[model samples]
Target chain A: MPKASAKKSAKPVEELSYEEALTELEGLVASLEDEQNPLEDSMRLFERGQALVAHCSALLESAQLKVQKLSGESLIPFEEESE
Target chain B: MQPTLFSSIHLTVSQLTLHIRKQLENDPTLQDVWVEGEISNLSRPASGHVYFTLKDKNASLRCMMWKPDAARLRVNLQDGMAIEAHGRITVYEPQGTYQLAVNLIQPKGEGALYQEFLRLKAMLESEGLFAPERKRPIHQLPNKIGIVTSQTGAALRDMLNTLRRRLPLAQVILAPSPVQGVEAPPALVKGIQLLNYQLPDVIIIARGGGSIEDLWAFNDERVVRAVAESKAPVICGVGHETDFTLCDFAADLRAPTPTAAAELATPITILDLSSDLLSARTRLTSLTLNLLAEQKAVISSFISRLKYISPERRIQSAYQHLDELSRRAFSALTHGIQIQISNVNGISKRLLSLNPEGILSRGYAIITRKDDHMVVSKVSQAFGKMKVRVSDGEFEVNRGLDTAAVIE
Candidate 1:
């Protein structure tokens, strides 16, 4: 049964950040609720939603690091990551 | 007089006391007392009685002024006054001490430190420093707000809280400064300068309530000038509702409290902005729809006009014109036939004028040879044996009978 399901599975080609995934999820929800899209587009959105959920779960597992610098004046080093 | 009182050994207590008070009141040496003193233990009771001790260089006297006499005094008595009092020295039997009962008082010199507050107020007013026309208008909605107050005071907390609740979008620049004491005025001026350099949209100078002396720093000329010269609009919220300062007059706007200043800085709510945006969108939609409707009407009218000049209608008009031309051609044919008939009649009359039958009636005859049935014009053609025909009948001619000269 697992080998039969693997042949039919559909996933996104590229990985997405948390914010990008959330934005795509919101757009997908809006498109599905619009009532103008056909059944084919609705199926595509359901498949994309599964990939976004997996990506969001991976981001939650990672811990963010914060660094502070003080030389009479205090400053916080910002993280470098693309949305 | 003492011997007379002594003689009356059985006198009543009231009579003896009256006689002794009269003797002391009449004494010239005890009538007036001059005291140069610093006042101590000064107590002004609610009943308008003043009880104080007046001390000189070496000694001090307990003094009491009743409500009536204290109220009548023109000068305000304070801790230190080198004064002279015009009254009799009296002894209180209970305390057993001689005290000066002040009747008329005069200051040795100007005693109570005269504040001259009105003088400074007049001087500032004369310079047109408090003119309402000179005041700048506060921004209706500031994008950035600068506050000049002590960082740890209640005024700062009130201002920050109010701003956070009312206008959270504004970027607040806190320029901390002392609000009281001698250093307060200079610190406030420096804060205003710093904010001016940064150029915030609005500045709010604020402090909590205190006594008159504590709030006097706001009246400093330097602070007032700093507020006046600031490029940004300044709002002065010094002390409570009752407290007014020179900075309040110099500022563009004055709020009763720090919280009120925050409210004044940002007047509109989110609902108002949203409503404005909605109205603009509605207007734009209506204008676009109207323009589209007008364009459609214009195109439709043009199309109708174009239909009038279409090729099919032009061809139909040409057909009607051809029918009218055919009718005119038929009329021309009838007129041509009549002209041709008249021409034929004229030719027939011309032919009749050349007729030989007509010529015979006019005494002319045509001659013809009988053999050939031809008309003869020459005699040579008719020989002796030939028969001739005249115009009316036939005749024979002989040559012998006609022996005449042959004319050439």
Candidate 2:
């Protein structure tokens, strides 16, 4: 049934770390390569792997240094010295 | 005792010195003594041994520290520095002199601090705070990093620059604190606590190289305990490679410099991570495509296999066999009818050949006496009126007339 994979893909892709996304993508590749899964399950895994690859690429493209200070309870912007 | 015969058999210098060496080496009070004195005539020879004389106003003692022990000394030795030395007293038999083989030494002013450091180290070690199993592995890719250092110090800048250059994806949370001074210990402890509240993946506590007193805050009991108890793994980079503090021992990992800590905090750089992501995507694509190809092949093979055993084909074959059987039956029925017709024709021909009517039509006749209806084969037997049979008629006077004509 489609119910098993529904829970797996429910988690938002934006919330995953780059490492997490890469790990999941690698796992999907391994399972798909195993050739034991049914056609329906293999398709589901491929879809998930595609999403993870996209998420990882997006994370790589969106690289900006974020330095902040812990002031009281909040994290304020950190002013870095000019090189 | 006879005083004239050289009293006690004049002892050799080597033999006397050996006796003195044994006496001094065996003395419980002299061995393992901690002597306090001002260092004098300190000379580090080419052999790496420190040959120094320690003297007070009353007397002086010759001290020799081996290369290994001398290397372990944290303080730079100089003449006229008041120090406390610990070692066993032993005699130099060649020179017939006694000296202390010093293994441990501490400057007089800093000696008490060193004693306290040792005591805390031993206590924390017993508590398993510095256990290898207690050390947590640093995250390969830290999303959020917490740093505790002086904002004005070069260490913070170095670490920031290194992190920004290597991996800018990580968000750094700086908890500025005085790294050294009387106010530093409590501030450092508070800074670590504050970072722990944020729950960053990793924490870096660092400062530039300095004297022991200058970096004493890291050695403070409160700071070391804070590091040991940190929720997130702590990386201490408080001083240069040679300089160490108690916090370094308590931290999950030790780095020689602040920059090194920043580097260590992110083991995988952005470039490597990006390449890895691309490779994984490629593998995922290729693997899925290969699976699809295999599935397609399986489906096609299934279709071909189904064609061989399909019921529709079997039904068609059954229809062909039924048609062949009907054709054979029809041919058999026609052949049997032909044979029956031939038999009937043969029987009718035989009956026709034996018919007496055919002989009558061919001008042959049969006669019999009228009295008993007997057949007359000879002419004398047919004198009277007799019956005669012909092919088309029957007559009574015909035989008599025929016979008379024959007689005439």
Question: What is the lDDT of every predicted structure here?
Answer: 0.67, 0.87
lDDT of 2 by residue, B114-133 (tens): 77889988998898888999
Angstrom error of the Cα, residue B14, model 2: value is 7.5
Indicate which candidate wins on lDDT.
Answer: 2
| Candidate chain B TM-scores, in order | 0.51, 0.59
Structure candidate 2, residue pairs in collision: none
TM-score of each: 0.45, 0.61
Least well predicted 10-residue stretch by lDDT in candidate 1 chain B: B109-118
- All candidates: DockQ: 0.02, 0.59
- Cα distance off (Å), candidate 2, residue B71: 5.4
Candidate 1 residues lying further than 4 Å off, grouped into runs, are A1-83, B1-116, B312-408
